[model samples]
Target: MISARNFLHFSRGVALAAAVCFFAATLAVAQTDALPSWNDTAPKQAIISFVEKVTKPDSADFVPEAERIAVFDNDGTLWVEHPIYTQLAFALDRVKSLAPQHPEWKETQPFKAVLEGDMKALAASGEKGLVELIMTTHAGMTTSDFQKIVIDWLASARDPKFKRPYTELVYQPMIELLAYLRANGFKTFIVSGGGVELMRPWAEKVYGIPPEQVVGSSIKTEFRMEDDTPTLFRLPEVNFIDDKAGKPVGINQQIGRRPIAAFGNSDGDLQMLQWTTMAGGPARLGVLIHHTDAAREYAYDRDTEFGRLDKALDAAAITGWTVVDMKADWKQVFKD
Candidate 1:
């Protein structure tokens, strides 16, 4: 009963609606692809399978939301840690800023080495000298003042190689993984060798991790009354080094429960991974982000100074840990 012209118009409207619906469905699928930066490789498949198994309510490997703890190493695991650690870079820069105050530092061995950019001399200065550098720059300030200093430094400091803010150097794929895990009812925590205060300032904004959820090395702090105000002053004293064996200790002290999944990049994280995945009651997930993409990011393992991956690399194979080859496994490195 319709006219020919009216029928043609109706057909056109139906075609347009179908096109819109198809486009929308395509977009939805694209948006839901959790780790778009990760290639469809063994590592990616392993991650998806593990997540599915644990998240599925009917599956035997299912973990309840309360017990879904995931711990991550900060430096080379989540962000770039090459040439030197971000915290160490901050300390070196601080030495230059404070050199004016201490005129004797110009002739001092370790301080002089840092000032002259003499890597050999700095290395010769040994652990004692390194401790001296950290103490001089990191101490003598209140907690609040130190936090402000760190915040200010992070805002201005740029990674020498990338020429971008250090925070921006964080891996896009890892960020996606973190989000994916959290979406699947996992509580993510940052367990790093970096100073707790150094990471707490920006971790929430950058990694979606809260300050209290961060566990790391700490310097001694003293409570004092400053001008009728209570303040906690940072001291030049070592509290704990959350690396290697200390990682497990830090995890226990901070998280109070054993994590079912752990992620790391270097030998320093081996103990944490072992504690998490090898404890072995049920299915567990351990992932190591192997930096193999020299073109996109730095490629160094087994002999790297910053993130030495010798022992852990060996352990991964024997323990069935997922070693993510950045070159082959990741579609991208940093986020745009």
Candidate 2:
């Protein structure tokens, strides 16, 4: 007969194995708690419940992979948008770099202000100044040339306030949520007010959203040939402004069908969430990422010079969109 001591040793081995299994299971659950990071509000529950119902093969609410459309705004929603928009800074930097070539820019109203580092004067010019800055530096070149310039600049560009790569400054929670949704068969797209071409050049590398999946503000362009060389040059004109009401129009123009899910963080995205949720769907979801932590990320609304969030807040309540308080919802904002 086996000794009682040997039997006890076998029992101890089995107990240790069971303990390891239990610990492993707990770790797995913790890692998969992406939705748990969200608040317990009705809007948050709606998203979690919908995702569960759709992913279950036996459920009547199961949505096919092709029908899962998720759209996200880029600025305040996906990354930081305080003090100023990153693209505007990009345009200003471009003005400074290209100013030497175009000496007339020294006399130009907005470009001259940007060159002289007179932000107060630039803002006083208001919308007219903002538009002039975008047009002068963003346009007037081949799309390929513009793309190359953005790529090269981004390599060295760091957020002036945070001192991190503008790309690295993206919200960590959103990045995790994006990957989780994609793993469950959701196709993600970025619908931002920023220039489409500007986003397309680096979005695939940064966010994993291919150029074809991006929809944003765009300028008009024409295909042409210059002495046996084919080229596509940007026009000094506006094609569409993908903000507020324009967001829905741009989505319809590009994505065709209404998205079942949408995310935004400002008045610029109010119409986008409205369109996403009001499209006669039983399982549509909308989320808004609110910047509330002034210490971690700058916070301002309505009267703020950039990324005014007041109108969007009103719409959030009316439309039942999930407004994620940055201070409460996310444990960390950036990788840094």
Candidate 3:
């Protein structure tokens, strides 16, 4: 019923509105800081500067999208690894859960230590006992079954100090950093000493990192046919421990290419950082998250049983790696 002139004017008005909305959205995105949780500190500036240099096509240090790889350690770097490692907590809980099936655990050295909540005894069990505990709790199931177990445990597991689910303890700044890197054409990968299967179940949901992008310690998995269906069964055998020196080996085997950026918290990530940043390259970034805030998060370094940061702390200073002081550099630790 409208005249052609009127209809044309109405269409133009709508187009103008759409254009204004689009411009506003673009402006908002451009103005938003990628890492809002991170304070405007030296570490944040360093991260942004490195990413910009590598991503800008006109920059001399520009790295192609295909070569833009960033690796992050999973424990204290991405999430909370305080009081104890998340995996260790899982193992301890698993020991208690399976204790009813194995009565001998009541008298077993490490198992008994775990059952009685004897911290001193558990520590005395050493790496060997820890390995034994991990094998027993993490193996003797199919890969799919193990994944379900991990998923289930993570769903209900709560940090003793924070009383929050373990997954909720992930660092907000790190999460933002991961997304920022990905947004800038970098493929982010989790290279951790935690069990690969254990992390694979929740990595995508929590960190937006896929299962294949995770490189971590793993137990032996054997292929077999179960009732006509092919299955990969986990075995109680140590395959690879992706910590310290093993990190580079795992990266080569899994990702096949070197990462230009690496992030970590503890000494376990020293070799990984060295491999990523020290490799002859255009512009590489290495960041160490120093847990310096005891109020918001647990702070521990050289003296801590888990996530010992001594060697890495010293190396960061010498190697020019940017160390992020959690208390000063991060405005918020965990996402609300």
Candidate 4:
């Protein structure tokens, strides 16, 4: 018969083995889970199917790694864009901070609207007023100085609705999707309508996309030498608008290769989707993220002022694009 001490030693060995097996199993699950934050719904399945179709060398839809480009919209698609855009919030805050220097701003329509926390008045100011605000606050500075200003603002600014830093408000499912694509050898680019310089300041740290790969609206800049140091000075005039139809134009000028996949959330992205999936040789993927979860995240479409999802909503059905119901497809919203 085995001694009691020998039996105890045997039990210890078994327990250690069980612990190691559990750890191995947990690691295996993690490695296999491409989009853990996404529910195992039709949208998730479609994403996996497309990735597999394009990446599989044996498949007819196989696309080379160099041509497997995927473009994503920044504002609503990657992160939160509700109540007001993050950039607009920054502009409003800048107006308030600069109010002491420009006492006349207190009487100015758009600046006054921002100072008094009057969102309705700000909205009434229209595109022209918005442009004025952007130009006044964003221009007349070196590009490097502007980037530093942006980075500093984002560090202190919190989303009013979430009471969290704007960077922390990125969708968990989308983050996972970006990683999954990168792991599969796809080069992802952010073709947002937001300001390119504004995004380049923090996009790499936040989204793993480098500066040169980002494309967006920009203002004119002049090359100059100040204090024997070369600097690019931002001009108040608009150079390019990367929204709606301009998205396609931006893609053509910035990224010469047509993307095999495109992801976006609003009507601003409609032309982008059309440009990406249409006139395609291999199977192209165009997916739209519909904000349908009200309790977890704001739910508004066709009627919302920001990130409006009207025409794109109707086109998804007609064009056979996969429209993700955020409430159903996303298991989690923000990255807790």
Which one wins on lDDT?
1
lDDT of 1: 0.94
lDDT of residue 294 for candidate 1: 90
Error of 1 at 204 (Å): 0.5
lDDT of 1 at 12: 96
Worst 10 residues of 1 by lDDT: 27-36
Please state the error at residue 1 of candidate 3 in Å: 21
The C-alpha RMSD of each candidate to the native structure, in angstroms, is: 5.8, 6.0, 2.7, 6.5
lDDT of 4: 0.93
Clash count for candidate 4 is 0
Tell me the tens digit of each residue's lDDT in model 1 across 86-135: 99999999999988998999999899999999989999999999999999
Candidate 4 deviant stretches above 4 angstroms: 1-31
Model 4 lDDT per residue over 1-336, tens place: 879999999999999999999999899867899898999999999999999999999999999899989999999999999988888998998998889999998899999999998888988999999999999999999999999999999999999999999999999999999999999999999999999998998889989999998999999999999889999999999999999999999999999988889999999999999999888578899999999999999898899889999999999999889999999999899877
The runs of at least 3 residues in candidate 1 whose Cα sits more than 4 Å from the true structure, single-residue gaps closed, are 1-31
Identify the superior model by TM-score, candidate 3 or candidate 4: 3
Q: Candidate 4's error at 272, in angstroms?
A: 0.5
lDDT of 3 at 82: 82
Task: Please report, in order, the local distance difference test score of every candidate based on alpha carbons.
Answer: 0.94, 0.85, 0.93, 0.93
Best by TM-score: 3
Q: Please write out the lDDT profile of model 3 over residues 1-336, one tens digit for every residue.
A: 989999999999999999999999999989999999988989999999998899999999999999999999999999998888999999999999999999999998899999999999989999899989999999999988888888889989999999999999999999999999999999999999999988988899999999999999999999999799999999999999999999999999999999999999999999999999887858899999999999999778899888999999999999999999999999999988
- The true-versus-predicted C-alpha distance at residue 316 of model 2, in Å, is 1.6
